[model samples]
Target: MISFSPTEEQQMIVSMAKQFASGEMRKIYRQCDENGAIPEGVIDTAWKMGLTSSSIPEEYGGPGGEHSAITGSLIAEELAWGDLSMAMHILCPALFAYPILEMGTESQRKKYLPLFSDEKYKAATSGLIEPRFGFDPYSLSTTARLDGNEYVLNGEKCYVPLAAEADLLLVYAAEDGTSHAFIVERDTKGLEIGEREKNMGIRALTTYELSLKNCHVPKENLLGDPRGYDFNRIMNCSRVALSAMAVGVAKAAMEYSRDYAKERVAFGEPIGSRQTVAFMLAEMAIEIDATRLMTWEAAWKLDRKEEATKEASLVKTYADDMVLMVTDRGVQILGGHGYVREHPVELWLRNGRGFATFDGMAIV
Candidate 1:
């Protein structure tokens, strides 16, 4: 029989992460959102927790902990519950490090993994989403052509987290009609980092658009080098991560609304005592739990090295809708209060709406 219960170690890690989320992320989320920036001290605190570097091997100057997708999903949900923007920003380096750790050549790991093990937060990110009407990760518009010792890259990417500060970027592009990732240094010629983007949600997390015109990277910079990495598997991992985050965001909204309904009286009775409000809360709880379970299943498949494209895709789609529904209900429950910036429900609603377009913005 299969079990979804986390291991003892996993539980301990989750508990630690939960404390950090509630104690640190929650305290300043609104301020960060308003300012459109997360405090450097907060990011450094999270980095000190070794959230992103713990999985690297001892030889690479890390704790050599097992890297499990389920554990990643659990941590992701809790962090996102505290605040989506801070959660994404805290985990941004993982977007670059994890991929390389899992798929990069031995030399690549030796060269890059150590950078993440530093005491300070290292800025590294990925570029996958293109700024187009119908963007598809598998069928990217960015193109890379191998020429002698270098690969010439030409394309535009948007919604790249920390693009302005990232010292390294894993840029995905189509190579001979196949999607592949190329490691480009920050100062690479023809790689123009655009101004920060203003989005509807996750406002605290800085993102940028990039223009690559004949950008050249050493041929060896291709991830996994001689044998290319599995692009599909990478996408699946990202889907699972995003799905878990959706569960977190939805759960936060549900709990907040449920508490409010208990205290806010209408007709001389608490709003939660009413059937309509109670039923919405019940539905929100059920759907959030369902999505979390689905996300866990996908993460489990990834840990087992099983093909999880269909499962990941299904959970991602369901979570995208579920988060929007739950967060909107959160605002609806608060009536006029939800529309105001003072409450977090409106912020969550905005963040929830962007999940559909958040491909590769997160990863497990």
Candidate 2:
């Protein structure tokens, strides 16, 4: 019996996340987008919510809460509804923590999991997306070879969130044709953090390009050493997280356009009363709900510790199209007003366009 209904605790988490999104993130998303920087205070406020640290066990200096993909999806959608950039930025630490928590060795967990429990926001992130055409996660261009006691990494990575400030980075590379994650510490030799990337969307969340020229990390840094971790499962989790976020973005666009249609009158009648406008709005609502359910189903599969590659991939593909359609419809409904910065529909459209490229940038 699959239930889309969230548990009471999940509902509580969603409500809290919605408040943060509406109360905090919504207040400054436009300015953050325009300035290409989110205020530190806002980031600090989100950090206090324990969004990333609550799932770790008490032995790791954390709050000892269960980690659930479904709960993470619910929280992710609400936070993304507030703003994608801030939402991604706030959750970036999880990009590093969750994998280690789930798949790392005991020594790895003892060393790294405690870092996330700190009072301040820890700068940690992952590197997976490369800068190239026809990028595929399975066949990574980055290569790693075991040399002596260290793994020599060689490749370039782009769109790495908070790379400049991060003290730790979980860099994914192809080792003997199998993709694997290596824990690379900041200041490691041959690991060059390049200039911050200028992206078309999610502009406020600073990302960077990286050059790893024979970068050497201890063999012990290999995630799930002695036995490799499941790269497919990680990718599935990432897909579900991003898909939920797409639903959130689309939902935001739909509700805003729907409200605008009801209020923005033309020829003494609300545009929402018109047949074409009503149909478009109806379709947007339908697609957004459909995508949300798809996201939840994938997330539910993940929580069951089942293989969710097919479901995750399907939802991700659908979400990529769904968000673009809904946001474009939002712009269409608003006419000229949607093209301008005065309204957030244009911003949502811009942010919505980047979902297809946002793999490994988020996770649950």
Candidate 3:
């Protein structure tokens, strides 16, 4: 099984995230769910705790975290156990932050990095997908044409989380039929944001439609690779984090089911006394164990700087499905209580349905 036993530093981070999440973030979870609003300070506390910057390097005044794929996953799992949306929001900056730190020019980093920590600026999102299709970025329809010192971008992107609240967009656009990435500030000419999408799951995260009507971006905003940018690598690096979130949701389901079974009465006694009920819990344990092993293997491969695309793909796909089974069973064990809006299990199931959607985890 994938071992989650953390090292001294890893354990310390886990404990810190666990403590804070159980306290502050836990209280606000349902509030955000009910109101579909994430408080402004949600990301601040994570940043202050250094958990949000766990993937960033020290050169950028960050925690100097070594890009260990497993470590970040561990952190994500812990934070997500309390609330998935909050966990995602805390780590969302990495989507944009990573590309800049890895590929941005000194001038680019100096200008954009400072905005991340500044509450006045809010956050920036990585806009890579298009309305044309999902998962495959190669199907991009956006065009970026060089015009003197700047590039003019025209295209629309959809389903990007944080697009509504982003101050800048790290968008992927085509340059002479070659894929290139552009960092378009929100105020850029002809840049427009459509209405927030009404999604069934992860409602706290507001997805948006980005319209760039011949938008003009400065020359310096481009990152590395003049040719088409590689979305596979970006998605691969993010796989571990996604698995960790699933782990968190699964862990929550397991614990909730166990406790509910123990207390819930049945025909003869508490449901926990039933052999059939015990068997279901046993199955959950098995899936969780297998998924953990796979997730860690993928993370270790990434830490060793090896190609983990297949391993990550395998884990993300199975883990998402496993969480659905586990959570659905949790609801079954809860009987009427699980289906009611008063319980969190129903919400967990709704949120879980999409975990397998993004990044092409479905039947791929």
CA RMSD (A), model 3:
3.4
Q: How high is the lDDT of residue 240 in model 3? A: 68
Error of 3 at 331 (Å): 1.9
**Candidate 2 residue runs with Cα over 4 Å from true position:** 226-228
lDDT of 1: 0.94
lDDT tens readout by residue for model 3, 160-231: 778767777788877766566688877888988889877777777777788899788888788754432344
The TM-score between candidate 3 and the true structure equals 0.89
TM-score per candidate, chains pooled: 0.99, 0.99, 0.89
Q: Rate the local accuracy (lDDT) of all candidates.
A: 0.94, 0.93, 0.74
Model 2 TM-score, 2 decimals: 0.99
The digit string of per-residue lDDT tens for model 2 on 196-263 reads 98988899999999999999999999998646488898999999999999999999999999999999
Look at candidate 3 and give me any clashing residue pairs: 2-293, 58-64, 179-228
Pairwise TM-score winner, candidates 2 and 3: 2
Q: Candidates ranked by lDDT, best first?
A: 1, 2, 3
